[model samples]
Target: MKSRSLQPQLANLPNYKVRESHKAKHVNLKISPHHGLEVVVPKGFDHRRIPEILQKKQKWIDKIARQFEAQQEFLTPTAADQGVTEIVLQAIAETWRVEYVPTSNPHVVVTEKPGQQLQVRGAITHTDLCHKALCKWLAHKARTHLVPWLRTVSHEVQLPFEQASVRGQKTRWASCSQNKMISLNYKLLFLPPEVVCYVFVHELCHTIHMNHSAAFWQLVGEKDPNYEQLDAELHNIWRYVPVWVEH
Candidate 1:
């Protein structure tokens, strides 16, 4: 669908493409890094009304869209850019200068150098292999930094979970099960420390309230007073994630 399909009331809004899904029960609007201004609606909903719904949420949409552009600049560098040269991990408060060298060998090799530098050699010309090697190192960083960090936060917040697992989740930042198990996204390394703490507090509350009811949000507020603001930030947290990691 085209922006022309929208009602005249939304003429001022940016053009948005539409997609209809039978599985969808409500209208959903969000900006994708690769696809801008996408609107998904139930198969039979009045398409004209989408503009009104979007108009009402224009402020949020614009805010999130702006974030996508300003997210980790290295994630989508400019035309002159070659590859990921350096990475700064705010959650861990560490920055690594990177160097890549192509080799005739088939396997990629990585080494952590002095002065906060990293050397990647072998198959450097192969983007897929290079990304794989980088992600493997990132997982190691998550285990070294995120796991212990979560435990420390859980202790400080007085919410001891049974277990914690980190992963490359594309859609979710974290989740807690009734069994007291918690799973977190490794991409969280890209977010600010305070934002990361908010995700933990959110999931830890799930140990008490699985449903997102008013009571659940109240519990989150008690733990993190800025839960509302943190929740809003999560809407476009993917901006922090590097495109090379493949989520």
Candidate 2:
């Protein structure tokens, strides 16, 4: 029997990357910062067809490239006149302790405790490393606490999820894919449990409706009537937390 193939089409407008990955053997498209088109084929896939594909997609590629350029310009951050000091890692570590105290400087000093503590020491030269460590620690905590809460909320809302995990995501607090995979950001740990539940339910509802249409919001509101207010509070409260960066 002939193997099934994706009926590739000439997109009227420019699209993103057309690439293949071991994770996704199927032809996939993604938007990257630099490359306009990334075509990925299987090991035995014909390379000769690539040029034809590109030609067919030339108009789309050009339009998407221009849009990407415009978006890049808008996303550029203004240059800072002076360097901003990063939060101290020690202070972050100390914050986890029961009797943690913040010093005059942005450092967290911890009192001796039986269990582990989170500390933030802004004095550390490698701010990125410190921030990553902090994010990891926060992720661990969220995973421990949020999973059970998610299960309860899922049951209450009569929504089912295949799997749930926590990570350090920058742009989104939580997301649910079409496959019912749910991910929550470690930064969510900074929010109160009520707010966290609001985010969890919001993402969980996505498993039912993939887009943010009025129906999606209605589903979210059905679970938690005050979801909108809680979501707004979460965003406002999390604004004070420092951004997580990798070393």
Candidate 3:
């Protein structure tokens, strides 16, 4: 969908872009370091009321803007600086140095070389293409390691799941569906091994309990005695994830 830019009527208010989403049921505001302010409204919503909404939420916007500004340097590097040089997968205790090689091929291809190195071949000058190649490789690695690990945990807990898949989800680390299909975010490779195991247990338990009720917690606790502490660690672990993965 195309997003329309709106100039702030009040000089003190920050500028925001207005976007229409078919899935949206009501107007929502999003503030991120990468995109700044965004006003998302449902389709056919009146655009004229945006300015008034912004005025009412002026203080909240200013507060969130300042918070993002404070964490700007820690969030992600600029686009020009996103040329990934090294990747550290704490979950598996592996580190890799990335090397970009230019070639005449039409597309980029990522290959693993000896000595813990990743070689990005083909039109390496195209930044976005390189990112896609890296993400694809990450997903492959996640599946190679995570799927077996999930199965091991399932067998240990005697909880059988129907299926497991991996993706580069932005906000969540993992999810379990009603039918026992679990989707794990490849980003979990950046987290600690114990926390990653907790995530596996978290989703596996969902095979029995669909909600986060006390019963679910009891089951998770039975599997991982320190579930509370491990779960808390996941809240702030996103800082360790490389910014290039998100781009």
Candidate 4:
């Protein structure tokens, strides 16, 4: 990787401490808004080499630190801004309340109600259960609305994918394995239909191109020219949905 010099303002900042042992190979550095600096080194890496590496990359490290600080500023939510909890509550109350129905079985059903409120009903009694039910209901809706669009994109891109399935996934919105199976996140139901279609089409494209290389992105663009903007919007929507934790 190319390395650059640290900014002048960061020259006097304290250097992050590094530890080396027999279990390290190469050093890895990470900067995050939540965690200021983190360094990881594999076993057996030469401790003497670290100084040279750090010296060569000092500018880059400072740049990354500045970026992390900027990110911290961006993530500090204001009081007027309804936090994620409130967003989830509103999403549930607005879209989940009217459609929710608790049944003896463990399934959640989402149907159009006479009014505007969304409903959520399930057999379980805990908040986690309620969240899972909402996930299921949302996944069902996303699948229903996105499948036809997925098929169209698949055909346009000449991709070979058998079918699409929707479920609650913690780490990703969608994934496509070599077997041509497409798995979508159920929470996509909360997004606009176009954004849902973007996720569906994104997974379907992966069937033909397994990696996120230039070719893969080109294929995605062929299917949806506005894929990047849609992707950003989808990520923004996901931030409102709380992380699912199993009870």
Pick the lDDT winner.
3
Give the Cα error of residue 93 in candidate 3, in Å.
1.0
Residue 104, candidate 1: Cα error in Å is 2.9
Clashes of each: 0, 24, 0, 23
Instruction: Tell me how far the alpha carbon of residue 38 in candidate 3 is from the true structure, in angstroms, after superposition.
Output: 13
Better of 2 and 4 by TM-score: 4
| lDDT over C-alpha atoms for residue 171 of model 3 | 55
Which runs of model 3 end up more than 4 angstroms from their true locations? 1-71, 76-80
Best by TM-score: 1
Give the per-residue lDDT digits (tens) of candidate 2, residues 17-131: 3343333344433333332345655555665575576666566566656665665542333211112233222212324442223345554222223445344444334444344
Tell me the tens digit of each residue's lDDT in model 1 across 128-164.
7777787778777888888888888888889889998
TM-score of each: 0.75, 0.52, 0.73, 0.52
Q: Give each model's whole-structure lDDT.
A: 0.77, 0.57, 0.83, 0.57
lDDT of 2 at 5: 30
Residue 212 shift from truth in candidate 3, angstroms? 1.0
What's the lDDT of the predicted structure labeled candidate 1? 0.77
